[model samples]
Target chain A: MGDLFTDTIVISVLAATIRIATPLILAALGELIAERAGILNLGVEGTMLMAAFAAFIGAYATGSTLMALLLAVLAGMAMSFIMVFMAATLKVEQVVTGLALNLLAAGMSLYLYKAFFAVEGQAMPTVAVMPVAPIPFLSEIPYIGPILFTQKVLTYVALLMVPVVWFFLYRTKYGLEIRCLGENPKAIDTKGMSVSLRQYGAVMAGGALCGLAGAFVTIGSSARFVPDITNGRGWLALVIVIAANWRPSGILIAALVFAFLDALQLQIQGIGVQMPYQIFLALPYVLAIVLMVLKSRRGRSEEPARLGVPYFRGER
Target chain B: MGLRLEPRLAPSARWQAVSVAVALLAALAVSALLLESAGTDVGVAFAAILDGAFGGLRTTAKTLAKATPMILTGLAITVAFRAKVWNIGAEGQLFAGAMASYWLYTLTGPALGMALLPLLFAAGFVGGGLYGGLAGWLRSAFRVNEVLTTVMLNYVILYLLSFLLVGPWRDQSSFYQQSERIDRAAWLPDLWAPGKLHLGFLVAILAAVAIHVVMNRSWFGYEVKAVGLNARAARFKGINVERTAVAVMVLSGGLAGLAGMIQVFGVNHRLESDISLGFGFTGIIIAVLAMLRPGWVVFVAILFGGFENGGIKMQVATGAPSAIVSAIEAITLLFFLTAAALTRFRIVWRST
Candidate 1:
């Protein structure tokens, strides 16, 4: 009986791990695409915030999870479009552009929330969180089923994207061209293909994926929207991409590591451990710095040659 | 191509100034449109903002008071950015300074009287400097990117502050996550009776002047510039790039820390989580639009400071949320960056 109890606890923690990894996976994969295309879009945090706000608004207004998801994806894409436009067309400094987008989102989202959401003499309005979908026959298994198969639809999509993204990056022609843009954009320019166009495509696609990640933050789990609710998760995804060495499978493992830490913290807090919860909250950020230091020390890296540099057709 | 850009050998100063003016005007136009669309009267909002920002000596003093922290933070950014060392952790460093100075004040229990003021400022500078120095050390020792490390530190310190606020430092009489007020003896001397302006404004200016001297008239400033222009070239020229990076961050973080210390003693009179209203982040916009020039930072910070006060008044006069100021700040930044980029090239028409 004791063994069974321990087994159940372990399975529960692992299950929570899969569930929490959803947003990180989606956002990091999106970041990977953008980085592969030579645009270091550090605006992922802002994009996620905008998408999360949009999803909350959509879900609250229409009471449709699908509609919320669509709105979120659109919001994400719109935010990223700004990043691509400023970075590609004007060749503005990507770092400053990214910072501007994040600040814009912070102000706009709060302004909209205050202006539209709050009602007089009422508690904060909330929408119904999405119901979990347990797969037939698959969710009945003892350990693995509860841990992996019985999650929200977005979790499955996030996991499935690992392979899909891998295939797109390695076996596909467009993926090859996108990678080439980062490595040597002049090659694509010499071939008469528009470097700017390819960057636009890659970044927008990444933004759409980020939209999904953001949607999961509020519509999928929480009943109401909170300002800066994504918190540092979006930034964590950026760290995961670097720690993953810019590979789909590596991202999967790195994301799981972060998710597991979060899941374990939740469980620890649930059991009412005798420690400050703030310490648990601070772990991932602390670990992110450690991971980056370690990654920098290691050999055989896969960093893009010209990751943050803007391309010029005539430049040497 | 219908139109193309040709690089300007020397971008005309007159055109740069004109374009920047047009960009600010355009940002205002966009803000007006946004307000109109949001069911707010553009006229009332702008007028209210102007009145709140500069209508009288009191409001004008308040605006300058508001700009005090920003000037320091803006200079902090300008100093580091001039060396191309990105220190995104100024927000965190600011908090570190506040917490450290407060802790010192509590320990000393105002026994030192007004003499404690300089000690608190020193503690703040050291607190923020050490926090910033960690990221610098990481960059120099581990080749870790300062951007990520500094950002992570920002989040980490907030949690630390949160813990201290709720656990050890919690104000028992009050219900918020903040510490007890500092001794009145340590409060900044009031500059004017019209508004609650304090000595912090003068300090910010003095800092700017000191920074102007350090950055332009000193050999260390030249080393920083060389490293920013090209690290490899600087190293080849016998400059220690890594050490310079650490020194730049220390200076940047120290100034940001001073901003935090001043906010507590001069404005808030107590250290709380909300003491900093994203002043550190806004410094980036100010520094960038100022073209990383310290002289321009003060003027830009004052303009933004006016926006802050005006935003509150506008929110009261109209139903619009005061966050519009932040949005406008960002819009101005985007437009200014574009205008700066545009100034580098002249439009050329091509025959197809």
Candidate 2:
């Protein structure tokens, strides 16, 4: 226990925390936008899975990390269109549609992976990881720089996206419109704006970010794609968005905390702790529920007023 | 000339059936594209799936055995969904029930003999009900969103199951991450000799019928449907919305729990991590496809069960991935959902 708190160990844990949180932050930020716009796209998990598989296939085929990322983003956007059509146009139940999409994505990804990469007893093929782009002088700075400055280009972008999303949501006019859409799409419709169009844009952006998040799991962390690679990261992002009270800054903190627990689990396993690893694995989810319950009890519901409600132009 | 959509006052039963057919056809079309891309002949692959699902008595038994849990879970979803309670933790509830029954059977099977079987079912129902009722309580008491809570509970329960499998309840004799097989007297009686078919399938059918009666004929069912259709109105009419919500969830959960126990006693005969492969999640699809009708749920579950059992054969015959069945199920649900929405509005041709 004493040796576990060593400086090197501390820095490595912090680094792992950041590395693990990168995908959540990216996906949460996207979810932040959609949630703000009042569309609960529960299909984030499915979208990410689809994108992750697509990214892996692209990277495996082209050996170019950039191309792989591009394909992932496109795949995510494509999946999001389904949500837009279902929840936005068809006025279907957002939760069920999202669940359906998740199932579709999960099954499709496994099918595609098996069709393209099934080799009996052979390890999954690997792809070239995105090269780390460490800021030269900043990376040299002791604890902070090594942990923050030295990461893959995607990680840096994901970090940078926090502020970018914050600015877009709070500062920009279009961002204001998106927020208004969530709280009161009727008001937006009264303003002669196309509520569906704004929702489409928000969900598409969220989808792309989730796709990038998925790609990072395969390319930024692991070198190969695996089945259900996103695991429950997308779901975690949904919880983070809610726990954060729909605030961008809050999402950053929630993602980091969840990631810290994730990293801690791995470290404890490394230290050969006697406790079952499943307990540690289950910690983050349990904590999220506790946090959500507490947040809800506080009587300050920050949920979008129109969240999960379909917009039909003339419906009362 | 232009086409327009006119909002319908109410959806007709004929249109509802037609929509389902259209959704299935559309899903099949999409599957054909996927199969072709995967290098499997679509016709041959589907034929293989069909043959595998209904080829002979043996295969038909397998399909019914597979459908048992699905039918039970689907009824669980149907009950909760009809009442407007989104109990998405059916999968977790199933596991909780299985864990409860397994623990009870292991504890009392030797000492209590055949009496332990009913006790196992009761324990499973109680375990699953309590687990589900927790979420329902949170939602009704604290206004917590059941969607997130249910989904979160799923992971938590899954981890708990994993922990038990690896730690205390692990089979000591076998290296597998499973528990010791239940006592012979604790096992569900077999319905067919030389086959795995058991009385659990009959139980599923009976459960569906019971659910149908409860949903359509009972006052409790009336309250549930009332709350689902309009909670505020139901409350104004002096219905205890909170109590109804909690009761519906418990019932739904109990059904799901019973499914888990049945799978254990009727099929696996031991607790294992992979005892269920998303039966709870598939229940959602089944419930939706059946339009939340218990009787329809039975037919749909059987259809899905055939697909599930046949998927293995399709995989072996055409070398197509078995996951395609899952994809097809999802696609069909999506199409059905879209068509359901379409029923609310009529397609009309108009001159511009």
Candidate 3:
């Protein structure tokens, strides 16, 4: 009674929650933009993996966290370039193309890791993990301050992105055009706007955000890159996008929910819970399926009509 | 207007053959570049791959042994993708099969004598089929995306397997989280006594042949194709689209589960995590590169099997990472898909 649910533990768990949610929020918002633009980039996981690996390698080589972040973003964009090129230009099956990117990343990352760094089989190279940037006055506040203010810079950016993404999706003209591309690409094509061009833009931008998400997984949180470091976090973000119903605010809630489970799992394991840790490890994915079932019950979902269907001008 | 794409009424066989060849050459060229960049001699690596694949009878047997599980997973993918049902949980389904078969063997191994092996295989099939059925039901009933659900299920089953291995099934003798070595009587008989080729390879070949016939000649096959081509039209034509989708998943999952069970009974002789080294994902590449044809699946799987076996040898000799093979396989699929798109369309210069 004095240990598990104590005030100190609660605060630490909540703080961990925010830190874990950072990448999910970034990736989910990125996926949201792609879904809105009528491109279902199932390659988000692959895009994130490539970026995470790129960020890790960059950090190790250049010894600059900023350069690592930039490298990750560029890697994310490069992967999305292939995704958009295949989906928008070549019109290959979107699902297959996305899977190809995933497999490609899985193989290429492991190959490069082994060839470049792991060849020695000596000490695992470490990077300077992002220093936590606490807000000046806000960080001094009580429980709330530690939970929210004391976080990496990317964590704050992830939170701020929710509103920024909301504004861009709902308020701006280009956002309107992008949304129109998802619901009715023919409408944009008829009005003399390039549907594919906007799709490329939306997907590439979303990819950049996923890059940042990937960067956070490495340079932001951990000091060393492990094989399959992102694990299923990338997939979890896809689930969050669906649970969020493709909305930004909903995405933040859904991400925090999943991240909370992760944080709680970490805390419970730390306290030496009686149950096997694998059960806790498996909870988020189980909940993801449950959340999807709940999502399906809610009618009038905002899923884009043309999502996953490639647009060809003049085709009904 | 400069250039336009005009759909070919029916793509010529020659164009397809040429495109595939070009895709292969380009993919191998990239692999060569990767090897050279890694400080490995390109010519030696390529020669090593070919020699390791088919240098002698012993090497060829190893390649076939390596290809066995992939062939099954490849067939699993072919069955599901044929009906446009993306069941990406072959990895999880494989584990479920292994666990189920192992559980059944431990429970009834003494009572069931000769019937043990067949029953274990059946248990594996049922186990995998049911796991796949769950995803199918979720997709059909709840409108959950099969891709996402299947992917999640893969991770869930892995954790589940990890829990079982550590808790209930941990072998006391060894420190690893794995089961006791299976009974010697339960081992699959070797197809070639002198070689490493086992009866499991025969089963994979048989599965491939069965899948080819079912996909091409059966009425259920027609229903699956109809549903995949156009679900709405298939429904209008009196086909139960949802049920077909579920059935497709069951059949696909059964094949993958069988692969996992065979890996346990035939190859490793124990249940372990390393049973699947991204075989499910690699199966996707194999199925696609084969153009989703069962006959081609066997050929492509063997080719990849050679790369895997060769890459390991190259690593020993040249210190290059064995991961180059997987990278090469993925690059091939991407290039092939691009070439397929190019061949499917004929470019026309338009002047308006």
Candidate 4:
């Protein structure tokens, strides 16, 4: 009985860990694509915020999780189009443009919320949360079944996208072009391919993924929109991209590790740990910083050569 | 068979001006679509913004008041940027400065320190500079990127402040969770009777002039700008690039810190979460719009400040959410960045 109880608790925690990591994994994957394309979109935060809002609004209006997710993805792609215009077409500093987009996302979303729902202190109705479905035979198994198999459709998509992204990035021609441009835009430019077009494509891909991640927050997780709800997760996603060194597979592992840490915080709080909740709230960020420092110290830092600079074809 | 076009070294000012106009129109068009979808008139919404910002003398003064700290934060970014030292952690440093000022006032507010507002301000300046210098030292010594260090330090400082405020520093009497209010002696005097505009406005103007002189006329300023333009080239000319970087960051952090002190003394009069209101981030926008020039920062800062100040009034009156103003700000920053980029580099499309 004792062994069974301990096994159950561990499995349960791992299941919770997967649930928490899903959004981060999705968002980080998007960031990986953007960074791999040599455009560091700092506006991931804004993109996520807008996605979250769009997801909530869609879910609330249509009452269909699928529709909400779709709208959220479109909203995210739209946001990325702005980055495309700024970084790819106009050749602005991608980092600054991304940062501005984030600010714009937050401000615009909040304004829309206020303009519509400016009730003094009334709460808005929450939409239906994402439904969980368990795999037929696997879910019936004692410990391993529910932990791995039973989750929202989005979770499965997130896990599946990991290998899909890996395959696309490594085996595909378009992915090769992206990697080539990131490594040396001048070389890619010489190949008679428009470096700008490839970059715009990559950023849009990332933006769509980020939108999915944001929709997950509203429809899949909370089923309600809150102002500034994206908080700093978008930034965290950026850090995860770096910590994973722009590897899609590594992004999966990093996302799980960070999510486990986040889950641990909640478990500790649930079990009445003596420490302050604020410390736990800050633990994930602290961990990311420590991981970055450790990774940098070990000289295992793998950064693309010309990551943040705009490519002006003739300039050296 | 195709003629290749030579890339221009510099984009014409005409492109920049047009880009700015295009960006604004784009932002407005996007915002209008959002409003239309929500079933609101775009005209009424924008009019509300203009009126809230400049409808009255009281509002204009309020706008200047809002712009006050922006001048300092804008200068902080402009200085470090000119030296090519990315100091995104000004928000963290600003928090540290406010905390330091709070500490000073807490210790001296009720006692002999009643006559020491100037001393307290000095302490605030030193505190912000030191915090900024910490990131600088880490980068210069360890070759750690300032971007990462500054970003990390922001979280660390935020947590530290949270720990202090929620635990040891919590005000005992108030319903609102914040630090103990400083004695009246440490409080900044309002410049006018009705408006909340304080002595901080004058200080912002004076600092702008000081920065103008230091950036344009002074050798130190020239050295900083030279390093920004080309670090290796500046080093070739016998300039101590590292020292200049450190000095500019320290000065930059100090100015940001002073903005925090002004908030604590002038507006809030107590340390709270809303003390800086993301002024540090907004300063980046202000600096960009001003084209990183100290003189231009003044005009840009006031415009942004006016919008923010008026934004609050608009929020109160039209019930238009304050986030609308922030959206405008975000759009404005995006536009300015794009404009700057277009001015610096323009691509001519010709099929080769």
For each candidate, give its TM-score against the true structure: 0.97, 0.97, 0.98, 0.92
True interface contacts retained by model 2: 0.82
Tens-place lDDT digits, model 4, residues A259-290: 89888888888879788677877778777766
Write the candidate numbers in order of decreasing lDDT.
Answer: 1, 3, 2, 4
Question: Candidates' lDDT values, in order?
Answer: 0.91, 0.89, 0.90, 0.81
CAPRI tier for the interface of model 2: medium
- The deviation in Å at residue B37 for candidate 2 is 1.1
* Per-residue C-alpha lDDT of model 2 across residues A1-316, encoded as one tens digit per residue: 6764698788988988998999999999988898888899999889888988888888999988889999999999999989987888778889888989999998888888887787668887888888778899999998998799988888888999999999999999999999998988888999888898899999999999999998998877778778888988988899999889999899899999999999988988999989888889889888988888888878567788989888777768
Candidate 2 regions exceeding 4 Å error are A1-5, B1-4, B12-14, B347-352
Q: What share of the true interface contacts does each candidate keep?
A: 0.76, 0.82, 0.82, 0.62
Q: Model 1, which residues run further than 4 Å from truth?
A: B1-6, B349-352
lDDT of 1 by residue, B1-352 (tens): 6777677889889889999999999999989987887789999999999999998989999999999989988998898888889888889989988888888887888778778888988988888898888999999999887888888999999999999989988888899998888778889889895798998899999999999999999999999999988999999999999999999999999999999999989888888898899999999999999888888999999999999999999999997988889989988988888888888878989986
Model 4's alpha-carbon lDDT is 0.81
In CAPRI terms, model 3 is classed as high
Window of ten residues with lowest summed lDDT in model 2 chain A: A1-10
Evaluated at residue A60, the lDDT of candidate 3 is 93
lDDT of 1 at B198: 93
- Candidate 2 chain B: 10-residue stretch with minimal lDDT: B106-115
Candidate 1 lDDT score at position A241: 94
